[model samples]
Target: MITSISTQIQLAARPVGWPRPNDFATVQIELGELAPGQIRVVNEFISVDPYMRGRMSAAKSYSAPFGLGETMTGGAIGRVVESASDAFPVGSVVLHQFGWRDVVQEDAAGFKVVPEIPGAPLSLYLGILGMTGLTGYVGLTAVANMVPGDTVFISGAAGAVGTAAGQIARLLGAGRVIGSAGTDEKVALLTEKYGYDAAFNYKSGPVREQLAAAAPEGIDVFFDNVGGEHLEAALDVFNPGGRAALCGAIAGYNSTERKVGPDNMVNMITRGLSLKGFTLGSYLDLAPEFNEHMTAWFTAGKIAYDETVVDGIGNAVDALLSMMQGANTGKMVVRTAVMADVIR
Candidate 1:
């Protein structure tokens, strides 16, 4: 007789700073019959993001910490192989938050049905057409209140959000787009691929100097991803009435010591600058609006997205580590199924 089983990665230990291989454990569980409203999904792709690092810690945050010994969760795109609900029948494609597993058995209420895009990979739901793309849109439109002809500056310019933000800023009528990345190669891609007007390697010189050189006219908007020194640098050169959407602080995610706040915070008062930190949850109400624009841009071939794919659910832990270390060029994803398993 055949049996049903699922493979999942569970948090075994909390990290003091950077996560380690020992922090996670992969286990196989025998699957049980689905309840009346539940479904069985086989994940095609799963996302590994910077925000997941914060979830690993036990500290109180905007989102709940991942429970110890429980399977880790994030965004995933999968096909419903079995379903007990009329809402989602067999062969349906769905998006859900029950990731880090090769297979998931969950209630239909948590899963959302997504329309299949022709000639598009399901992984796009975890990147450009997903939260990563929405972050850029929200930061530019709602948080920073971007206006046409505003000069925009972005830190961590080659990561998923940064790359999307640069292009989105252009589409919104930015006069100039400047970005800073860790490596020279990423810096080149920021301008050549992402349409940034000026791109610099943060490692090449002091951030303050590099940013000033890149944006001599001063920036009207700042989309921050890597905080710490980058935040201070933005503050130093912001024009009067400048606005910033403070998104992530990857610079301090793994620090054992407390990271210091920007030294030039007084600029906010003097320059009338507005800096707002946001989580995707607070801006989720804009999803319908964002999806409409993103879909249009994608269909018109105006928007471009890149994915750094690591094969197999077994390497999910390694993929997360690599992403944290900036090993990937764009959105980092783990492929749970082989090509033959994916219908789309």
Candidate 2:
């Protein structure tokens, strides 16, 4: 008698530029009887990332693209209701790949048991303490080779990865952290709240000039999220032997095709620059280190974050595309209806 109403969003059409509402469809589904070793979870919040827009189209990327008519792929954290196995009991929380769904019944082994954080908010798992945090940590520590006293620059400073990167760099003893965001509000938050020494709104002027002003002596490390112009600009401002942790090329996701690579490739030779493309999935082994650092930072009140949450599972498509359109102020999460009414 445990019936679950699941709201599922599927890719209806490939987007040409910006994704229209019609490009996705939200459908309500009925759950069947669960088999042994199966667990049904009521999804609380799902992530909406800039990288997901690429999955909507049939283009080659780090992860497989979503089929023309398939459920959008992402991450979600949920609460288990009816469990057919003892390993996961009712009332336990879990994390799984149940993206854009209200409730899901998957194999018990498919999910990871989330440790309790009674004082901290659950939404932290979808942001600072989750995969997004790990992405920034691994990129900075491993790929960027960041060290204490190094000057850092971050593109897309308002988004999840960018925000986390700036804070982590400061905590690791960076001398300065400069960032670029889309809006004046985000730029202000970067400097005032998130501990960035300097930040600017990329929409206001050329990225190169803005970065040069923020980092007059040049930056030792650049954590790139908004690619294209941001990437091009980083090349001009990187200190000799500086490293670039290329986390995402979000600015070019909506473009028709490849528009421009950095014109300052010559800087790579003269300055001994290194730009590396990285994904969080490739550095799962470093998750323990990231979680340890982030947990302590959160507990000690050293880290800060923001979230732009949209209510209702039906509006998931809008929330998902908003990350690409720069409509989101911080981490974007599609909040399902089960929360607040039942918890708060």
Candidate 3:
């Protein structure tokens, strides 16, 4: 009989503005022997995303709020150590929604086995090879209808999805790619490493002026991650018949007060621009197509990504908070002790 203990983080209380450490409670629970058709997994890496901030709040949204006192759930990839099911044998790598926990034992149906990609860390499954990459790909192709030779601009370009969006935009044949980051260092990284034609630090000056200076001829496509000022800037600089994919509004995620809408409301009507807001759930039908294209590009050495890894499940809350504050340059993930010696 295999008995184990799992360290899990739970939502203790709904956050008001920004989440505090007190809002999350880390606890340990012992597990009994696995039942028939059940599997036990030790997590390697867990994802911490900006969208999760919304889930912490009690307000109604696209995804249901995380129940108080329950384990925080998101994306997690791990290896099965023991299993009673034939489908998930011992040592199979799997991905599941049982997140923020170092160990999990659940029915086999809740987990999906995935093959290990040679030379790439399994953590990539939590980032570029997973939802983060798919979001960027779908936003550009399906939602924004980005065509070749379009001048593309991505806000919050140093973050995980933003970095992926910038690189994917270039590969999609955009004539020019511009990005905005919080700091000058991130801005430099965007143009130098991510193939962004131009990049600007949004904190340096007014977003409208900086964006205009970057795209003097005007932009045809906007992949917006930061709303408020960034959205306003994109609208002001968009060419006639331009398009936008409203991916996120992290700027207002922690606000205690209501955020004002963009002042440039008439630009949409006068410029004949098209804007669409989307959640990944509505566009998951495109996953097969995204995997094909992304796999080919990544395997061919065309894709470049960065990850900011924090060492332990206990610090998951800190990692999430830092990421939301733009302290991370790329994907922010929490690594567990079980991750050791797994990836070559």
Candidate 4:
């Protein structure tokens, strides 16, 4: 029998506006033994996302708030180290919502075993091949109803979902794909690497002006990640009968004051545009479809992705804050020290 000490991060205080490092606390617990039907895992990658900021708040949302003084939960991938269940033996890779911990000991039912793809990093399961990728696929195909030759626009285009959205749009036979990022370097990456037809740095000029210059013919589909000015810009440039998928409102995630909506909302009535807001929970039924397409695209070498990894469980809160501030190029994840010993 092997005993292990798991270092876990707990939410100490609910945050107001931007979360501070003091809002979280790190604690260690000894895993003395595994009970019946239990499995122990050493986490490799833990996901940090924009949606998590919403969970930190006490307000009502699509998901329940994280309990104060409890270990936080989100997407994580790891390999089983010990197991009492035959279904999940030692050495099996698994994905779960155990989150922010270097190791986890839980019932086997709480984790799902996933295959290890040869030559691919297991961390990919937390990003391009996982929920992040699925979000982009569903937002474009189902929510926005993007079709062949439809001109598409994506805000926050250098981030995980945004990068995936741009490439997915091109593969879906979009006539043109435009994107907006926070920096000039990201704008270049979008055009050179992610297959975006045009990209602009949102900080350079007004979003509406940049978008209008990029898409002179007007956009038919809008995959919105940043709201506020970006949404207003989309509304200003949308062609008649345009459709939009409201995937996230990252722009105002940390705003202490109530955010004002897009001023050009009346364009929806005048131009007969359709805007639908969605949370991934309601659309999880499309996972199979998403997996099929994403797997094929990835296998065929049509997908490109990036990950900004923060090393150690202690830095998880810092990683999340950096992602919200547009510091990460793609999906931002935390890599535990245990992951360093295992390359694959």
The lDDT per prediction is: 0.90, 0.86, 0.92, 0.91
User: Considering only N, C-alpha and C atoms within 3 Å, which residue pairs clash in candidate 1?
Assistant: none
Model 2 worst lDDT run, 10 consecutive residues: 335-344
Q: What digit string (tens of lDDT, one per residue) describes model 1 on residues 7-73? A: 8999999988989999999999988999899998888889999999999999999999999999999
Residue 3 in candidate 2 has what lDDT?
37
Judged by whole-model lDDT over C-alpha atoms, candidate 2 comes out at: 0.86
RMSD for each of the candidates:
1.6, 1.6, 1.7, 1.5
Best by lDDT: 3
TM per candidate comes to 0.97, 0.96, 0.97, 0.97
lDDT string, candidate 3, 1-344, tens digits: 12388999999999999999999999989999999999999898999998899999888899999999999999999988889999998889999999999999999999988756666788988888889999999999999999999999999999999999998888989999999999999999998899999999999999999999999999999999999999999999999999999999999999999899999979999999999999899999998898888888988999999999999999999999999999999899999865565432
Off by over 4 Å in 1: 1-3, 342-344
Judge candidate 1 against the unseen true structure and give its global Cα lDDT, from 0 to 1. 0.90
Model 4: ten consecutive residues of lowest lDDT: 335-344
Stretches off by above 4 angstroms in model 2 are 1-3, 341-344
**Candidate with better lDDT, 2 vs 4:** 4
Instruction: Give me the runs in candidate 4 sitting further than 4 Å from their true place.
Output: 1-3, 342-344
Clashing pairs in 3: none
